[model samples]
Target: MPQTIPKKKVRKPQKVGKAQKGKEEKMQPMPVYEKEKIPFRLRDKVAIITGGDSGIGRAIAIAFAKEGADVVICYEKDDVDAKITASEIEKNGRKYLLIGGDVSRENHCQKIIDRTIKTFGKIDVLINNAAVQTPQDELKKISAQQLTRTFEVNIFSQFYMSKAVEKYLKKGSSIINTTSVTAYRGSGHLLDYSATKGAILAFTRSLSSYFSEKGIRVNAVSPGPIWTPLIPTTFDAEEVATFGSNVPMKRAGQPVEVAYAYVFLASDDAAYITGQVIHPNGGEIVNG
Candidate 1:
C-alpha cells in the first residue's frame, strides 16, 4: 500500500530549452503532485505500455506503478531514457520489464504480449501509446515512404498490439489508445499524423462495441499539445518555443497532467465508460 503524503505543488519554470528530457530535468520548479495513498486502485494489475521510454508513455508507466501495477514498457531504442524510467518504476516498489523493439512490426508486437504474460501471468490494462510524427508543410512534400512509416507507428501498431493482447485480456480489462486533438481539429503541418489519429478514434469506438459482450472495455485519450520528446525532436526551435501557447490554458501540459486520465480510464471508476474519449487538451473545447 502506498503511504499517504501531503499534496505537492509544481511551479512553472521561467525558461525552457531543446534536447527533450534533458530540458525537463533542468526545468526549475518542475511539476509535482502528491502520491496516491494506501490501497492503490490498480493494486496487482499488470499493464503494457508501448513508447514507454519517455514523455507521455514514461509518465503513464510511473503512474501505473504508483497505483501498484507491474509495468512492461516497450521502446524502439534509447536505453538511456528507458533506464531512467525503469529506475523510477522500481522506486515505486513495482516490477519493471523493458522490451527494446519496434512496435510497428506485428511480430514484435506478438513478442511483447508473449513476454508480458510470461513475466506477469496476466494482462489487465493495455495502453497503446507509442507513436511517431514528422511535420510537412505541404501535402505534396509527404512521400509514400514517410506516410507508410507514420501509419505503421502511429496507428498500425495499435491494431497489432490489440490483436496480440486480446486473447490474454480477461473480463474487466481495459485498453486505452492515445489519439490526438489534431484528429478532430486537424493540423496544417501534421497531415499524416492527424490522419492516423482519426483512425485511432474510429478504431476505439468500433472495438469498444465489439468487446461489449466480453466485458472488456476500449477507449481513447485525445491530447492537444503536451511537452514531450516528440515536440523537441519534430519541430524547429521557434515552433518548440511557442508550443501549446495557442491553447486556452496557454501552456504545454506536463505528461503527469495527462497521465491521470489514463489512470481513471483504466480503473473501476470507468467501469461504465467505453467507446468514448477523454480529452486532456489544456482546456481546448473540441467536438467529437
Candidate 2:
C-alpha cells in the first residue's frame, strides 16, 4: 500500500555513499503501511534482529522500538541503512545498538550476542533474519563456494546466533527465524537458497523441540516476494519488475507488513505458540 508503488529497481540515490540506501525518506512515495496504526504494544523488551538494517529487519526494529523495546540491529555493511534504522529506534525513544559484521562467521555470531548482553544486559527476543539468495536457472550454476556461503549465512547463522543467546533467554522469551516460502515450495531458480530455507525450517522445528522444555519458544516467519533491498541488488531488473505480481495479491508485500508477524510472535500474546511458522506470502499455498 505504499503511496508510490514500489518498482523492482535498484533505488540507488544520485549520490550513493558508504551505505546511502534509498528506503526511509527516499522511496518514490513510501511503502503503504502507516506508522500510526501500531500502538506500542511491546514495551520494555530487548530485541536483537539480524539483518535489521533494512527491509523486514528495519520494520521489525522500528516496531519493537515503538513498543518500548531496546533494539539491537545487526548487519554487514550498509552502514547508512543501519544508522537510519538506529535513528528510527532512537526517535521512538528506545535504546538500540547498530552492529556491523557478517553473522555467518562464528566469532561475529558470538560477538553479536556478547555485545547485546553487554549493552542491554539481557536479550528477550532474537530475530534470525539475515540471508542471501543467489538465483541460478541451472543447478550447476551454484559453485561450491556459493553453496557453502549460502548455508553459512542462510541457515548456519541461525544455529550460531541461537546457541550464543540461549543462556540469557528465559521462558517468556522468543526466537524468530526468517524462513522462506521456498522451504515449503521449492524454488526452481534459487536452488541453493531454496535448500537453505528448507534447512532453516528443519532447524526451527528441531530447536523448538529441544528448547521448549526450557521455556525458550522458537518460531519462524516465512515470507514470499517482499520488496526488500536484496531483491533489487541481487536479481535482474526484469525479474525484479515482475517480482510479486504473480502472487494472488497482484503485488509483492512490504517489509513492514511482514514485520508485524515478528512482533506478534515475540509478544506474550503468542505464549502458547511455538515451533510454528507464520506465513505472510501473498496467498501462495505452500501446504503448511
User: Which of the numbered candidates is closest to the native, going by highest TM-score?
Assistant: 1
Residue pairs with backbone atoms closer than 3 Å in model 2 (clashes): 1-32, 2-31, 2-32
Give RMSD to native, each candidate: 15.9, 18.1
Q: Which digits, one per residue and each the tens of the lDDT, describe model 2 over residues 15-100?
A: 43444475556544455553344456688889999999999999999988877799999999869999999999999899989899
TM-score of each prediction = 0.86, 0.85
Q: What is candidate 1's TM-score against the reference?
A: 0.86
What range of 10 consecutive residues in model 1 has the weakest lDDT sum?
Answer: 29-38
lDDT of 2: 0.90
List runs of model 2 lying over 4 Å from the truth.
1-39
Model 1, runs deviating above 4 Å: 1-38
**By lDDT, who's the top model here?**
1
